[model samples]
Target: MNATHTTFAQDNGLRNIPAVDDFSGMINHPNPLIRESSPLLGFTVRVKTLLDPPEDKKLIDLIEQDIRHILLRLEAERYEPGILISWSYFFCTFIDEMVMARPWGIECWAQHTLLVRFHSETWGGEKCYQLINRLLLEPSRYHDLLEFIHLCLCLGFQGRYRMTAQYQEERERILRLIHQKLQSVRAQQPAERTALLSNTVIHVGSTERERRYRLHGLLSVKKIAWMMAFIALAGFLLFNWQLHIQTENIIDRLDVLLP
Candidate 1:
């Protein structure tokens, strides 16, 4: 079976027929210039088309193209660079195995600058996995998945895309495993492993500076406090000792025990 057939067969009787079919009709209308009279109908139609596709390759192609074009055009103006990068990274690197925030492959456009889209269906929690899984089930669409994963991971969480010490450690640990897998592959080049290690080290180095500086600052503060406490105790003891010697001399003289 072709990609469309496979997709349709898998979704057969599994999705809401009315909703899927309704959405399909709205999206499949011939005239591109005409506005969808009913926004609700348009959304349902789009959803239905994806849920229920005919076996026609051209139809499937058109549907895919339309969905992508519409979504991109709708989202392009948002321009969230951090989310875009983070979404791109996740979409590319991770697999949608556990229904968690796994990567779905997708790419970034340089000028777009935005790292992510804010739609719930796209990157809003668990729904993103459903979208990703649906896309991967169809052939010739893995590239989009790759791009999404890369941007998502690279962007990390929000505008704070740069790796912190903890995050850098985690990334290195993941890369270490990837490198191990690469090594196990037959005929893999030595340079590949070296490059992976180098990248991991570089990432760690980038974030280490901040962690080290904070640690050093903390230690310095502790050291200063400890020094002050020790000086205070020493002064107290010295003063007490000198007073005791003077008191003893005065007592001997008063008692006339030592003249």
Candidate 2:
């Protein structure tokens, strides 16, 4: 099945959904867009986060062209356009929170700037994950999966490996085995591996990315706050200036009438 199947939400196991209050594990991992979201409490992956926002002309126009089709399938309302910005920030971040904000392990695999959209469903929460498991074992997508898995390990995402002490040995064993498989594949296709690995290089703190951009989009909150403050201050000054001028004219009129 393709990534946008309607039945995807129904097949998800119980463990896939996280408790709404507990933002631990992948769920709590750095969101790159938390600074931009006004997420409502008690909902799965969203709310005022969507309900309404100041309309940004640039963002709204971009959504009309690119994102409106892929999200919020049931209602005509697409999510708030401000949270969804130039990096395809809103949609990608939405997907991340829904998938990563988890008490559960991501059982499978998976955009933006130029996102690949499928019209069948708004891939969010359970439905988003359902798409992942459906495509988990497919070889074409597996490469992308491994690419993501590599980054997740580097980012300290432990998933089910940290869920139990019994899984500890299994974790090490799985690591070694996967490493072995990678070696075998690399040995067989060194050139292909090299080309793929060399395609993108991201500097992630002490580590880096050997794949396409995943979690790199971040908007500086300090700068945003400062910019907003400056704008408000300027508007206040302008309003005061106008008010002062009006007051002075009123005083002049009163003096002329009294004389």
Which 10 consecutive positions of candidate 1 have the poorest summed lDDT?
A: 196-205
Error of 2 at 107 (Å): 23
What is the per-residue lDDT of model 2 for residues 221-244, given as tens digits with 9 covering 90 to 100?
577589899999999999999999
The models' CA-based lDDT, in order, is 0.32, 0.35
Clashes of each: 46, 4
Model 2 misses residue 37 by how many Å? 19
For each candidate, give its TM-score against the true structure. 0.20, 0.26
For candidate 1, give the lDDT of residue 258.
Answer: 50
